[model samples]
Target: MYKFKILIEGYARTGANGVYFASPTSSLIYDEKVKVLVDPGTNADALRSSFEREEMEFKDIDIVFLTHYHPDHFLNIRLFPNVDLYDGTTRWHGDQEHFYEGRLPGTDIELVPTPGHTMEQTSLVIETVEYGIVFVCQDVFWWEDGKQKSDNVNDLLNNPDPFMASWKDLQNSRKIVLDRADWIVPGHGKMFRNPRRN
Candidate 1:
């Protein structure tokens, strides 16, 4: 049997691109004693408040997973000094894919490479006894009631890129996730289940 939990800080609005500024939003998935902090948003204060509300502390965290290098997803990386950092391998900073193959203590956590929202954007899939599969996707997929939409294309277009080429990459990544994920906890939206419908 497996278990999971999602701790959302707060919502950070972004451009139509759906970046969500990593404001105060983030989540944690613990396999019993091993905990993984996924995408720490920009609000260290809010994060602390959330912990206090739950009577939890940062020291309880074991690792921090960064989906990409965007400001909203990483500005607070400095907050967790004790947590080991795991990020996408293709990022301008470092390649994290090299470490994706290992298994964690008493749990099964998989980091899938779903780039295109940014070159380094990756997502997490935690297999649980109850939830089946829960994905904490950074910026790879956005939802308008479970249906995949173009929120990201609009945002990414604002940057320098072969628009068509990037769009293709984004589409491919979306398909990859669609094939496996059942429950999705997006970085900046309400939690979702049965993610293909209203």
Candidate 2:
């Protein structure tokens, strides 16, 4: 079985027109085989503190899973310069690149292509004995309050605050994730039970 821990619970504040800054939630997933860090958010200090508290070093992490190409979500990847990065579609390790379609090689984790916040946005899914099915979905679902209304994707797409790449894609992505996730670690908040699931 796999296990996960939230390294950083992220947050954001929105200002005027189209102006918002956020730090994506960072998560750690591990089993007997591998240790993966998801979305190493912009909170470098918090990340360092978490590592120190856990008595961990940079090398302990094997892969940095970037849910999307956004900077806020991936900024702290610099902390793990030597680790491999799975950027939704390709895994980058030093001078080598390995491309994967669905499941990442050598792991039970499933990579779902959940676009819209950005075109290449993706969510990492894994089933664990403790958490059941977990989806570390970045940006696809972001809210100021962790329990933002999700019963209607149309309402989400209609919200003027968020910048979306495609309404249709985000709508579908939200539905797909909500349908399957027992719990979700969203882009800029703590993990919560999937409202649609409960």
Candidate 3:
């Protein structure tokens, strides 16, 4: 079983458009053999402090998984240069592309495409000793006033902007997460249990 910890709990603030603007959440998962860092956000110093608090260093990270390429979520990837990175997209980073998806190559962690926040977004599912199936979902949904909300989906669907992709795809993705995840760690706000099951 793996051990997981939330290194950073992101925040959200409502904008003039009534849509909530969210910050990126970061976490770490490890066991006797595997050490993975999920979504290193825009703040490098904060991440560094988190590592220090956990008695770890930048060199200790074995794998980096980005839920998407949003600046808040992925801009700080340079902080961990030596580790393998996965985001399920074919994009170049300094002339090298490290694209990976589905179950992370050597580990049991599964990367599920959860596009809504972005076309290339991905979510993670991993079994742990404490929690049977823990899902680390980034911007697939958000929490507000202690209730899970999908304002982003509504915004994308209701808005007249032709650039936004199909909201149906995002709805299907959310269904996938709700149907499978036992516990959920959202991109912003606190980790919560699957209320439907409980």
Q: Tell me each candidate's TM-score.
A: 0.72, 0.88, 0.80
> For model 2, which pairs clash?
none
Off by over 4 Å in 1: 14-24, 89-107, 143-165, 196-198
RMSD of each: 6.2, 2.9, 4.8
lDDT winner, 1 or 3: 3
Question: What is the alpha-carbon lDDT for the whole of candidate 1?
Answer: 0.61
lDDT values, one for every candidate: 0.61, 0.81, 0.74
Indicate which candidate wins on TM-score.
Answer: 2
- Candidate 1, 35-138: lDDT as tens digits: 77777878877777777876878888776777777677778778876566766442222333333333433346666777666655677787877777777775
Q: Residue 18's C-alpha lDDT in candidate 3?
A: 94
Number of clashing residue pairs, candidate 2 = 0
Model 3 lDDT tens row, 90-129:
3345669856556776778787888766788878888988
